[model samples]
Target: MSIISLSSGVQNNLSIMPRWPATQVLIDSLAWQKLQAVQASLPGHLGLILTRAYEPRVSELGRARTAFRRAGICLFGLLYRHRKEEIQDIFGSNGHDLDGTHIDVSFSINGQRVRLLPLSVFTPMSWQARRIKKFDEELSMVLAALLAQGFQLHRNATESLQIHCDLKPVL
Candidate 1:
């Protein structure tokens, strides 16, 4: 079990509400950290970063399923929950509570939804256009996978969504 903490600046800045990019960096950093932790913990199998969705599709909704299958990683998705007690019950046999780790995001893509379980799962390591400037074959694969399924990334709802990751080690 690992402890996840948002920097005070990140926690407090949210009080005033910074711009999207600023908040994004914080989320990305935490996501990256958790990914690293999982990677280190489980040497061979790829770590699944599960997060919450409004009403997630048939698990691994986007092209991520095939991609994860090909890469040999598991992807889990679940509905969003706010309270710590409520979230505590959703854990897989693999892990628990995610140490209360959650990523709040405004779902950006249209006809698009990724079901990441354990309350929140992430696929954004590819979804962000800037990641190319910063990092994947990931985004393209996710998009292509979705396109193959006939889903388009048109602009849609602006509802604030939470992306959570369950640090459950899975093979």
Candidate 2:
């Protein structure tokens, strides 16, 4: 199905989707997971749709980035937590075994911390991109999702002390 179809499905069902803050749209964890599960692979059109859905206006991203810098909150890239029990606990048993990894944000907001899992799936990690051959594909999808969500890469800020607010590099 198309990304707009997916977006419509998500938008029509607020109960199943994560709520965005009033002022800005934070990517929805469930919708993303559903996308990963339903779409075998992301083509350019789907990728563009995903980007448009979560990407803040350039001005909004700049403002949010500045505010985050002032607040001292850093935007580390996504972290994957594959613990099955933990996933079940947070999302409940949905009839599917739910073996997929949940991507966490590893960042803070307004002085509080939260995990944002961008990819949600029901397949086991072994069958997924963790395999050597599929690793690159998985990595590309994660980076795309992060970038679409407005996380910019900071090449020179590898040192923690040098970072004010930054996204961890893919390297």
Candidate 3:
């Protein structure tokens, strides 16, 4: 399935991207565990989706890089956690396990931050409602981070970030 097929709202929100250096993160295992714990502690569908539908924490990020390439956006992937080879070997085994991004540092090149693709590219197709909600949370966090860093992203009604943007090297 394609990014556009995930959610209409995602498309609307990501249609316009703010000009900023796109940074994709590889969330540590602890973060995943923490999210899992949080879900477990909850008492309803929120916890159910997180506990049931969530994919295993990934190590190698080749698939994410591929998504970034497919979106044609320049994103710097950051990983803070080191895992076992077995875990890395299983990376990208499940397509639903996309969106391991977490912002670590924000920097600009030549005093100008480049434009980022829409946040939707990181999200994967899923039928669960709560899972989709989590994707929105990730996307919002990215948008908020960009805005906080003095970048501006607005929706482009005539174009989509996934099909239109070309990533430039941040260097």
lDDT of each: 0.28, 0.30, 0.28
Q: What shift in Å separates residue 31 of candidate 2 from its native position after superposition?
A: 14
| TM-score of model number 2 | 0.23
Ranking by lDDT: 2, 1, 3
What would the TM-scores of all predictions be?
A: 0.21, 0.23, 0.22
List pairs with backbone clashes in candidate 2: 33-120, 103-117, 105-116
lDDT of 3 by residue, 65-99 (tens): 44544344322122212222222222222222443
**Candidate with better lDDT, 1 vs 2:** 2
Residue 112, model 2: lDDT of 30
> What overall lDDT, based on C-alpha atoms, would model 3 receive against the true structure?
0.28
lDDT of 1 by residue, 44-99 (tens): 32222223211112333323433433332222233222222332222221111122
Model 1's lDDT to the true fold? 0.28
**Minimal lDDT window, size 10, model 2:** 156-165
Residue 168 displacement (Å), model 3: 28
Worst 10 residues of 3 by lDDT: 45-54
Clashing pairs in 3: 18-152, 18-153
lDDT of 2 by residue, 1-171 (tens): 112222322232121222232232334454444434323344432221121123333555435534543332222212234342333232322211121121222222232322222232333345443432434453345445555544443232111111111222234
Give the candidates in order of TM-score, highest first. Answer: 2, 3, 1
